[model samples]
Target: MTSQLSADYKVDHFQKKATVVGLVGAAVFLFAAVAPYIFATDVTSAWIKLFYLISLATTWNLLAGYAGMVSVGQQAYIGLGAYGIFVFNDMGLDPYSSVLVASVAVGIIAFPISYVAFRLRGGYFAIGTWVIAEATRQIVIRFDSLGSGRGRSITTYTEDAIYRNLFTYWVALAIMGLAIVATFYLLRSRLGVALQSIRDNEVAAKSMGIKVSQTKRIVFVVAAMGAAAAGGIICLQGLGVASPNTIFGVNYSAFMIFMVLIGGIGTIEGPIIGAIIYFLMDYYFSQMGLWYMVVLGVLAILIMLFLPRGVWGEISHRFNFKVFPVGHQVQPLFPGIKLKKK
Candidate 1:
């Protein structure tokens, strides 16, 4: 009798998961199809940039959020994607294709780097990533194929024409859409549940026969892929070339962390909320000069102190709200019984 009850519980668990996934996928596709037309204006350029940055934060959230591996060197992957467009340009492939190539290449390359980074724990891991980013920057700057320091230019698909601009803008929107959808898909899968288990209690998970290291490695690769595509998307919009310093900058990683931290670390939706807040300030603050950054610093502290869970995290806790519902949820079975997956 107990076994039959457990089987029924399992069915209910999967049922809820399916509903969440279907709802999220439909909403994301609808938004992606509409965002381009709704915010199509020069003045709305900030929104474009927000999409790009949110994609970056999403990547970081995937890594630091699920895997519990807080890396500060994700910029290396971003830089690779940025340069990829130019690399493909030189090879005569489409710039958009370069985004794929860059992301795949970074995911591949990260395997070896992960071997090294994983050797360090906590603070050491963060510092090791920075060192890797610095090394990548120096090496790329010396590569003759990519102009040193001066940076190479990407051939605008339309030579600065209207169609080219429109396409570039749409590409940015598509990239963000892809990132959000991919994250949602991963979060609801068996892998996503496994990742959450590891994040919440590693030793407990390991005792239950979970392969913690392998799971983290896979997530690290996913994070790299997302960050790379984000860099490629943003660079495409302005038709600009990426220099080593520009793409792999330490500041790049810092900004990513800032966005993620402010958005709410460990939650997928937090990154998007944080990106919106960030760009809003960036737009208004850039006009105010350095003082705006001071204000931003203050804002970060206030959010941290008052709302450690971040803006969206707090919202979720307060009202069970979610603009981004990408995680699996279990419902209560009975008032007198413990709530589990069922």
Candidate 2:
């Protein structure tokens, strides 16, 4: 009645092929970050735009996709980050240093804001966040030192066009890189499991001893800082125009949603893909003015209707491929191998 039982434990987030692809991607992007020094200002500026949008899209995806906190008011953090740059600059910090200040400032603001926003759930939650953003904008506009409604600029650096472009573009790349790395690490940790569990079933997660509120608060704060970092990059790259209307505009949220939706929510690669597509469309069709807007809107609607899980989501589902895998999978350890009898 004696028999042998053998089992091998295997735990891996990334597939072998995905690992190779990721390495290649890292190398390619590393080269792209230095393209500002090698290419024209317009080209570098486009890269800056792409990176910042990717940062925002990724942060928004973490919030709405992993945490099930659908917010339509992320512009609040963005605007706060933009203003933070001004504050830091006024305090005699360099623009690069100000980016850090802006991010921290936004995180601090999100701490209290989360307490209020978390009170409302579902649709009310979305509207509540938006109202908070609007209230923040109104309050910011009352500050004369902030240029009130007229907005402010970053006049700290007096460098040439090349120097300015290279510096800002590099900073944008750095911010985006940090965001992606941070998200990957966070999602691979135990907290990531709690976060996704909460997203899937809040009641069950709570019942399982998951501190839902605390987890969500941490995510909210991280997202705020990430978005604020993006905003700071945008401000620097765009030569600093922190207008309440522009920085706090709902359009930022809309773009974030569109990118995540089209790219695929809940997946890391989705937002990256979505941002590339968006940048391409904007760059090529922007001269068409209103028509371009219509085209983008129509494209987004088509993606939603046809690919509900998003372009990446659909492809991943069909092919079972993940460049940045998060979940576990089981496969045969020795397929077609004959066992020896003892």
Candidate 3:
């Protein structure tokens, strides 16, 4: 006698849990979007800071955690983004419009700069980026119209305080949303796989026919644009660049590192979590002066020693669930089916 049997299977990237999380997240985002209407301007205005911080952290994490590019010079783009505002604003564009235009300009500029930065690898690449940032700062300051190391204000901003805060808050929220969505989709794409493979093993990624340089350059420019948008938002929030030194300060790089490491590097959710944690700490403890920095340092050390994968990384590892769910999983349509041979 002979018997016939069949087997079936399915592949899935998005899990049920992820769907639930997505719905809840959508609700939260909707609430946040309508916050200006429901909450006081003062309360809604503070979210602008969190929005930019998340934007910065997410881009930095995308660079270092996924692409294996530990750059400490992202402030270069941040400063440029801030200054680009002044350039465009002076050219008769509104400050808000200036932010978008400046970000695109910075992305175009980053393409050529990536060529210079790509020359070195590992620690050299890190140092080269910092050098580039410092050089950029020096060059920017030489332009007397850009405040010459002093500072500048947005002379063309809206006059109403409430409307101004509302607009800025909306822009900030939009930037944060776009950053997260763009990153999520990017990581889900084939290029994201290439980038992660390169991060894990560049030589092997090349052997697999992945165009390492091109992929990295794309990420570089994208990350630059992201940083620039955040920078523009910072400028808008403060009404202008307070000082070139402050806007382009390496401290911003430190903050990026702190957020990515604390939230969990290499994951989309990690940076957001990390940024919120840092934001809370900064809001409450900044008044303590040097002690605030001390606390930050201590917390970083503890997280590294214990939660080496970061808070979200550890949590995800334990639960085996992902809110973003970029990776694929395969399952059998029929749990246990065997073909019989006669």
The candidate maximizing TM-score is: 3
TM-score of 1: 0.89
Please provide TM-scores, in order, for all candidate models, with all chains considered together.
0.89, 0.92, 0.94
For model 2, the superposed segments whose C-alpha errors exceed 4 Å read 1-9, 15-22, 331-342
Q: Write the per-residue lDDT of candidate 3 for residues 1-342, one digit (tens) a residue.
A: 743322375667675756776688778888898999999887888899999999999999999999999999999999999999999999999999899999999999999999999999999999999999999999999998988989888889999989889888888888898898888878878888999999999999999999999999999999999999999999999999999999899999999999999999999999999999999998889999999999999999999999999999999989875788787655557748443422
lDDT of 2 by residue, 229-293 (tens): 99898888777874679999999999999999999999999999999999899889999999998
lDDT of each: 0.78, 0.87, 0.92
RMSD of 3: 4.2
- What are the runs in model 3 whose C-alpha is more than 4 Å off? 1-8, 15-23, 337-342
RMSD in Å for model 2:
4.0
Those runs of model 1 whose alpha carbons end farther than 4 Å from true positions after fitting are 7-40, 323-342
Higher-scoring candidate on TM-score, 2 or 3: 3
Cα displacement (angstroms), candidate 3, residue 327, comes to 0.7
| Ten residues in sequence with the least summed lDDT for candidate 3 | 2-11
